[model samples]
Structure formats: C-alpha cells, structure tokens
Target: MARQPALSASLQPTLGAHRRLMAGLIPEAGFHAAPLDGVTFMRADANTTPAPVLQEPSIVLLGQGLKRSYLDGEVLAYAPGEILVVALPMQFDCDTVVQPGQPMLALSVRIDMAVVAELACQMDPLPPLPPGAPSAHARGLSVAPMDAALADALTRLLEVLGDAEASRVLGPQLLRELHYRVLQGPAGTGLRALAASQGRLGRVFRSIEQMRADPARELSVAALARDAGMSVSAFHEAFKRVTGHAPLQYLKLTRLHLARSWMLDHDLGAAEAAYRVGYGSASQFSREFKRLFGLPPSAARSQPVVPA
Candidate 1:
C-alpha cells in the first residue's frame, strides 16, 4: 500500500490533543466502552499477537501506533493519521504495534446504516459514477489518510467525551458531523455502495443484516438468496465475493461470535450460550467454537485479552 502523507504540522496539536484525551479516558490498558452511545475506546500496552477479531460496522481511528489487518489473503497496514472503515461486520486477523514506552491508543465510532443513509440524503448528492465505474459491490473495508476537517471534528468530540453533560448535549451533533465528513471522504465509497441498496452488494447486505439480527433464527442459503431477489447461485456468489465468506459460513461465524460474547460479557455458561445462538447440542458448539477460535467454548473466558 502506498504510504499516506504524514500529519501536517498544523494538524499535529489537535492530533496530540486527541491522543492525550483518549489516553486520559482509558487510564489503563484494555477495551473501554464510553458512556456515550456507540463510542468505544481502547488502549493496548503490549505488542499483541495476531488475533481473530469480529469487526462490526465502525470507523477505527488511531490516536497513536500502528495495526496490520489480514483478511482474505490481503494485508492492510495503518498508522496514526489514517482511519480504518468497516462498512460491514466481518472477521479479520489484527496485529497491533505498541512501542515499549508508548502504548497504542485508538477509538471506534460505530456506524448506523439507517442514520448514514438518512444523512446522505440530507447532504448534496454525490457525483454520478463515471463511465465504466465498478459495480455497487464494495469490499466494505478500506483505509485512507484522515482529512484535516475530520481530524478537527474528532478532536472536538474527544474534548466533550469526558463530561456527561457535554456528551449528552453536544456529542450527537458532533458525531453527526463526523458521519457527514465520512460520507464525503475517500473511504466513503464502500459506505455509499452499501447505502444505495439497489445492487447486488446491497442485496447481500440485506441478508447479512438479517442473519446478524437474529443469528439463532433458522436460516439457509436458498432462503437468503430468495429474499435478496436472486437465484441461489447468484446470491451465493455475490455474498462470498463481498464478505469473503459464504452465506452459511457467515451466519455460523456470527452465531459463534455472539455465543462467545455472551459467555464473557454476560456471564453465560457454554451450554446456555450455545442454546441462545441456536446450537441444539453443546458438544457441537464446543467443537465448532474450538475449530474457529482454537479453544473450546468454556475456554473463551481464559483466552488472553486483546483490545476489542
């Protein structure tokens, strides 16, 4: 990947302030979800091993340090002054780089597709697609250099994050502005493709949303394809092409991820977690969980911690 331009001198102080504010929010090293909606802060103090991470729809902005993401045989690397946008929920192998004295600090702002689509309509329309432009299908994952305006908005958002009243009263408007900025950015292509749900990518995303919303519900490729208004073969191909996983496989991963989260965050037991995710058999859930995560369902609590 081409190296992004360094953060200009004029933007350094705001970037520095962003870093400092994030550090203060997370005094220790771990994944910390802020009181505000859809805001998650993370601090990684140690160099982390490449771990499978289920990334939701969000934009990951680094205050400091670097990260390499491995997905579908493609490796993407990003450092400070760059942002990673996930237009869909997918799994990736993430490796974080933290210097000995300086930990990696980052924050994720979750994306709400409905809100994005609404915001897109409120703004000036995007330019028409050029001749021979690629289809609406998008990778749903992209990295780009952060724009100065976006950086300034983030800094102001950070400034209000620590105060409950400010977060409640001012955060929404600021966050909305950030989303608008994103829609106008280089990384906005994937989002636009997803929002303009008149093409194959949008159809596939529809199925994805269904599976993610109710992972325990009975689902099949044929049914998903039908709902997407495509033949089984066409839907299967489109789903895998965009998400890097087959439809059924994607649903399975979603179930397993949810089950694991239930076990860890909500203190559910393996059997209960499996049942909640529609696993009729605990043994089967354990087997598949171990296959994907390299550990049994019961072992998830014991897995080494990493930034969320």
Candidate 2:
C-alpha cells in the first residue's frame, strides 16, 4: 500500500508526456501517417461506432482510452499501458472509447517480417512448446503489459516525429529497439515461432503471404500443403492452429478485403471489383461484402477509404 503512490508518481510523467505529444500531433479524429514508413498515429475524440477493419500484422501501443476488437466470437480489449501485438492479418470489428475529456490515442507500427527474422537469429533458442499451450492460431493476437523500456522507446520515437531529418536518422533504430523489446516481452515466444523459417507457424506464415499476394489465383489446399512440407490433414490442423481460421474461410476473407480495397482505392465498380478479386457472381460478392462491412459495395463509396 505504501508503494502505490510512488509507483503512480513514477508513471505520471511518461503518461502525461505521451498524452501531450499525441494531442499536439493529431488535431482531428482519424489516422495520420507518420513521416516514416510503416508507422501511423491514430486519434479518436469520442466513442466510435463499431467498424470492420482489416488490420495488418503490427504492433499497436495505446497511450490513452480503450479499444475492443471482436473476432471469431472473441472479445479482446486493450486498455492504456498495454501493447497489442498482432502476428497475422486480421479482419475484425473494432471500436474505441475514451473518458469525456480525453481521446483515443495510439501508435500502429507495421511489423517487418525480415527484421523479426533477423532479430530472432540473434536471440537464444526458444524452448519446446509447453503441454496444453494455446496453438499459434489462437495466439495470433496478444495483449501484454508494456515495460518501461518499451514505453520510453515509443515516447522517444514520437518525440522526433516533427523533425523529418531526425526521424529519418533515428526512427529506424528506435523502431528496431522497440521490436527487440517486444521480442523480449510476454509475446516473444509466439513472435519467435512466427519468425522461425522451418517451424510450423513459420511455414503457415509463408502460406498466408502467398494467399494475400494473389487472392484471385486458384489456390488448392493440396498445393499449399505440399509447399509447407506437410500432409493435407496435418497442414489443415497446423494452419488452423496458427491462424484461427480454416483455409477456405481465410481465403474468402482475404478476397473480400481485396475487393473492397479495389472499389475504394481504384474506384472500380462493384462488378469489376468482384471479378478482379475472383468472385464469379456479382450477387454473391455483394452479399458477402454487405455481411462483412455492414453495407453493400455501392454504399461503401461514401465511407472514408484507406489503403489496405
């Protein structure tokens, strides 16, 4: 009980600094691209209506407010002071809420798989999987307490955002350090597993990349299994374990996301977007699009569109 005040005092400055920096950097409620590649700052001034978002594999640090992600009937919420690490592309409904006077503030840094692999090589070998440990599929998204080192690194990273030269010179190093710190934190095991080239999860990650690259291609489960060096049944089990979705289901979601991107970014018509993403029927595409996004493709034109 005696230590509580001291702890709170210690945390006050860091939290206050983060809040100030974010408030100054973001003047409105939307995603703001940072000068650096693969980094974006987000702010929301009030509770948001739930919206379907296709989030890439990334590390998200929340400095204020609360976020809830609904996926596969699971509700994952991350409060301020926690780090959310997503190890795979995820399509989910997300909403944010904040105290009356505060805004939702966060940093979203896309994960560089190559960097993860390089760092994993220098770290100590990971231990064997523990008995009854959750499979990699369900482990794709993790929320863990942020340590001081990571918090400090993130704060420093944002401090340099206003200076382009400093951001160019120092941003990469700080981002690397942030990744290293996360690799050493609670989500490290799952991250390391994903980075291992010969590991089961690693192979699954490779397969995911292929699917994303050409969602329109005729991809067969047998071929994907062969590429992963696993039998069909084994591949199915492993893929589900690592990604939380069956192969066909994952493919469907990927295609639908790509189709939406086409309609928004390229201004493709619904039929054209459907055909481009390998949908054979316009009605089928519209149905799925409405099901996932809560609106038909035609209605999506009015909504704000961001690059996928």
Candidate 3:
C-alpha cells in the first residue's frame, strides 16, 4: 500500500512561504525579537533547554522542524501542519527537536488581547458556545492540526514582509486576516473561549490581566469575584478550573516569572527583583524561586538569558 500524503495541497504553498521566512529571519544564530510587544520568528539548530517561568501568550507554528511547549505538567508538541495556542501568562518550556541538517523554524505571533478583542467584535458571533465551553479552570494552552485556510493566510502574511512598502500598507490587513482565519480553524477554540463575553475563560482572562498589573495588591476573593461577576466561590472555582492553578498560586507564579525577566534584562539584584514582585522577604522570594526554577535567584541571574 502507498503511504498517505502528509499535507493537503491547500496548505503547501503557505507552509513553503513560512519555511522561507524563517530562513531569512534567523540567518545567523537564532535570536528572539524583543519581548512581549511584537512578532518574533525563530529557527534553531538544536533542541533548546526549558525555562521555569515564562509569560506572554503567542501562537506557534513550525515550518521546517518540530517544537514542544510545556504547561501544567503537560507537554504540548507541534510540527509542520500543526499549531499551538498559548492564551495566558504561565511558566512553560519550548524545545526544538529538529536535527542538524533540519533545523526547527517557527513563527510566533504574540496575541494582544486588545487586538483579539477588536477582531472578536468584528467577527460574526459564533454559534452558541459549547456547553461547559467557557471553562475558567482549563489549561490556557491547546494544540491542533493546521488546516488550509489558516496556512494560506499565514503564507500571505509572511510574504508581506518581503516588500517593505507593502508591509507598511498591508501588514495590519494581513495580520487581521491571519487572526480571522485562525479563529475559523480548529486551533481557534481556545481564543474564541477567551474572547467570548460571559464565558468562563473570558472572565478568567480579565482577572489575569488585573493580577498581572498589580501582583502585590491585596486581592480579595470578593473583589476578583465581582470583577468576573461571579460569586466569590464561583470565581475561585472557575479561576482554578480555567487556569490549572488556584488564583493566588497563579499570582505568585506570575510574580516570580516577571522577577526573573527583570533580573536577567536589567541590573536589578535578586532582592530588588523580589521586592518589585511584591515579596516582603528576600529570603522567602529566593526559596520559592529556587523551588520553581531549580536555581537560586542569584545563580539564575548569573546564567545567560534565553532569547524567547
């Protein structure tokens, strides 16, 4: 019997363009685009070591090789014709499985909730959301096979980068189209869940933003519950249900991760970083940081920062 084909014709050209885009973006040793506020593309010759505290939500698609991301004790893997959706700030890891001759090349589009909100308003309302769909305690991570429409949109978006004039003129349009297409594809559910008003994940996402903005503020269960418009008990239950961690646990993790980023990117000492993240005791911060990351704060700071 003949082997089945791996990719549909509809997906081939777009994926081809993605492979080429990676080739250009990481022409030298792979580097990340500056963090959190923009797009970044990567191509790696070896598997990467994982990090303990990672934040930011982005879409991941591989053009040439394989990649893996971890969350909540689960390892999510993707490769050609696949996608990963990270919809919240969480600690995770990524590894490129492509070998020497076949480097892993992937594109990451950071999700701006603002952009997602804008696009969602423009989108035709989805059919009634699935029952138990807007779950708050679900993991904010998901993976899916890349379908043709999304692939084509991605291809067109990447092609825009080649023509500087066109990029300026058409970049936003292409980006919008890409987001729309993803929402229409299988990998879109997680995003849709986050975008839908009155949805559990949507509520959780709002609380997440609040917690991120003020990690040190004493957050009352009642206040956060009111923010989500759920009763105190409901809010607490949904928060853990959607994010795979208790609300306070999530806050602590987010703080620890942000502190790590600050230490690596700035001249801040461990104590300073801890204080910034709202920890009153430097020793307590060090203990938790070590437990989570397997390295003491100072030692982790001395290690080179990994380009995300």
Which has the greatest TM-score? 1
Residue 120 local lDDT, model 1: 74
lDDT of each: 0.83, 0.79, 0.73
Q: Candidate 2 clashing pairs?
A: 137-241, 137-242, 137-243
RMSD of 1: 2.5
- Model 3 alpha-carbon drift over 4 Å, by segment: 1-6, 34-37, 129-138, 220-222, 302-308
- Output the better candidate (2/3) by lDDT: 2
Candidate 1 stretches with Cα past 4 Å from truth are: 1-10, 135-137, 304-308
Cα RMSD (Å) per model?
2.5, 3.7, 3.8
- Candidate 1 minimal-lDDT segment of 10 residues: 1-10
TM-score winner between candidates 2 and 3: 2
Candidate 3 local lDDT, 168-274, one digit each (tens): 78777777777777777656766876776546777888998898888777777788899788998898888876666788888888888888888888978999989
By the TM-score metric, which is better: model 1 or model 2? 1
lDDT per residue as tens, model 1, 1-308: 22444778888887888888888887888778886899999888878878877888898888878788887788888877888888888777788887787888998899988879987777776666789997543676788878889998899889899999999999999888888888888887678767877566678778988997888999989999889999999998888877778889888989998999889999999999999889998888989999888888778998864543
lDDT of 1 at 136: 42
Residue 35 displacement in candidate 2 (angstroms): 1.4
- What is the C-alpha lDDT profile of model 2 across 159-250, one tens digit per residue? 98878899999999988988998998886667878887656667887898999888888899999999999999999887876666777888
Candidate 3 C-alpha error for residue 306, in Å? 5.3
In candidate 2, how many clashes are counted?
3
